[model samples]
Target: AQSVTQLDSHVSVSEGTPVLLRCNYSSSYSPSLFWYVQHPNKGLQLLLKYTSAATLVKGINGFEAEFKKSETSFHLTKPSAHMSDAAEYFCVVSARAGGGNKLTFGTGTQLKVEL
Candidate 1:
């Protein structure tokens, strides 16, 4: 079984500051981790993904995450925050099941960017 936990329920940052969002996961096998963002009344967008390729994965919008197997963590970070970056972020974990794959999502973390 695979599961994900988002450590923060809400994260607030001033514009041009750094942003960090923590995530932890547990999986029986090597899991596929992803960070997704959702805007108001918009569908989820893939921010980044880790499929066991590289330790450091870069995504859109100046965001990146490092997959640390020893720490069981995949935390998202941005060099500078922007008002347009305010959105709900979700940490997702997926693993192969008996016949198919199953995905587990963590509780969403809302990011608020203040001008």
Candidate 2:
């Protein structure tokens, strides 16, 4: 039981505004969650990850996510959105077994930053 669902198909924010992308997941056991961003011509980059350490995990580019086990959610948030932040965001769940990692990716949330 490893799956991730992005609650929104698209999220728009004005430049210098706050950004929020909702995400939910289900796992039979403790799961490692991550937020990834893909630009128009770039590969997927890791934004943040949760690995049973800190509840509030911080990552690059003013992005952070809180692993809420009680709620089964890992939502991505940023204090302000930048023009460079306009891209596709995905929430991923990783399960490690047999010396390998199994990853499940969310559909994606298209973030359109308005000027």
Candidate 3:
């Protein structure tokens, strides 16, 4: 079985500052890691993915995450934040070799932006 836990339910950030969101996972076998972002009432966009290829993966909007096997962590980070970055983020987990890619989504982390 595979599961993910988002460290926070919500995060507040000032515009132009850095952003950090923590996550942890547990899986019986190798898993695929993904970060997805969603704007208010909008469809989700894939920020990045770790497909058992790279430990450190980069994604759109200057966001990135490092997959750590030892600690079972994959935390998202960005050097700076933008007002546009204020949205909900989800840490996802999936089986790498599954027929249906049933992605398990984190509850969600709402990022608040402050001027």
lDDT of 3 by residue, 1-115 (tens): 8899999999998988999999999888888999999998999999999989989999999999999999999999999999889999999999745566778888989999899
Selected candidate, larger lDDT, 1 vs 2: 1
Residue 63 miss distance in model 1 (angstroms) = 0.5
Q: For candidate 1, report its TM-score.
A: 0.96
Give per-model TM-scores: 0.96, 0.97, 0.95
- Model 3 Cα displacement at 82 (Å)? 0.6
**In candidate 3, how many Å is residue 9 off?**
0.5
- CA lDDT of every candidate: 0.96, 0.95, 0.93
For 1-115, candidate 2 gives per-residue lDDT tens digits of 7999999999999999999999999999899999999998889999999999999999999999999988999999999999999999999999987899989999999999999
Q: Return the top candidate by lDDT.
A: 1
lDDT per residue (tens digit) for residues 1-115 in model 1: 7789999999999999999999999999998999999999999999999999999999999999999999999999999999999999999999887899788999999999999
Off by over 4 Å in 3: 96-98
TM-score, model 3 to reference: 0.95
